[model samples]
Target: MSSHAPDQARVIPLRPVPTEPTEPTPKEPLWRDVVGDVLRRERLAQERTLKDVADSARISMPYLSELERGRKEASSEVLAAAAHALGLGLADLLALAHGRLAQPTRPARPLRSRIAPRPTETQSRPGDVRLAA
Candidate 1:
């Protein structure tokens, strides 16, 4: 029989352990994807057709379509031509892509300390080797 009363006895509730907030690995956006997305968005906002933009940019319609779908990486000259056709400069296009990349969907992680922790005694000594008898 317990001597302590129910009120006085210690009671530990079963609760989930609090853990560090884990963020899923963010996928790095490819340059082609960023460029294609910006180009598509700009074209759509202007209510322009693929053919019109391609023709004005002096590029093939198929190639422009591929670029818009992020299936093809465009050369700097092609990007410049497309940007010019859309009344934007290469810098403007790159800036738009940079902006998209800069926006974060999750909280930024804290930077880790540059200095590593000292090894514990359990860790093997440097250059120490043992052979079985």
Candidate 2:
């Protein structure tokens, strides 16, 4: 009979895995989406069509449509053109989008203390190290 086995198991050290927070943070809306929403909303409020706005803005209908759908990111000039077409200045357009972003998507979370809570009397045990505040 022949048996071969390692005298001791090998140990490998690795970085500790990161743990997720107990409460998942809400995702923030993309800037493109926010801007697109503002443009589309303003145009609709003015009872205008995509083609009409595109022509006024001097941009291709397809490009304007893509911007409205949040399918493409527009340059500052393009955004300004679109805003002008909708009878809005660039600042006005940005303010509208900012309003949308400022609106909260989720209910407010309860405030959490920044400091770690100390062990309660019931949780204290022999050989435990207690730190003074």
Candidate 3:
């Protein structure tokens, strides 16, 4: 009886399996820290320190530090001046701040007004009695 296996274990050329190149995953958007992070990065890129920007923006160093650290919320005026010091438009800064701040906007309640009751048919059409049809 012949065992019907490969006569010489049929030589099979083992090819190397191809592998896919891996890319780094993109970072998630930071909606909450966008404003502070943008400001800090831009300042650093422009080679300006917090103290320098604070002096130019006419704000306290501690307050500006807080703003850059995302620990403090700034008023519109302060934000405007800070943007100016950073050579950016007030509108741009405001847009960045708006993107970060959460607006508590709830839908308005429906309006309901009390209306006077209508008079009965007898009262409206005096002396008229109609038969049921």
Q: Which is the winner by TM-score between candidate 1 and candidate 3?
A: 1
Ranked candidates (lDDT, high to low):
1, 2, 3
Lowest lDDT block of 10, candidate 1: 9-18
- Residues 1-133, candidate 1, lDDT per residue (tens digit)? 4454645533322433324554567789888988999999999999999999999999999999999989999999999999999999999999999998898967765544322344455554444343433
Question: Scored by CA lDDT, what does every candidate get?
Answer: 0.82, 0.81, 0.67
lDDT (0-100) at residue 130 of candidate 2? 38
Q: For each candidate, C-alpha RMSD in Å?
A: 12.2, 10.1, 28.6
Quote the positional error of residue 114 for candidate 1 in Å.
13
Clashing pairs in 3: none
Candidate 2 deviant stretches above 4 angstroms? 1-21, 110-133
Put down candidate 3 lDDT per residue, 1-133, tens digits, no spaces.
Answer: 3233534232222432223433454454454356777788779999998999999999998988888887877777887888999999888876766754544344333222222234455443443333433
State the weakest 10-residue window (summed lDDT) of model 2.
9-18
What is the Cα-based TM-score of model 3? 0.48
Q: What is the per-residue lDDT of model 2 for residues 1-133, given as tens digits with 9 covering 90 to 100?
A: 1132435332322433323354566889899999998999999999999999999999999999899889999999999999999999999999999999999887784444322344456654454443433
In Å, residue 21's CA in model 2 sits off its true spot by: 7.3
The order by descending TM-score is 1, 2, 3
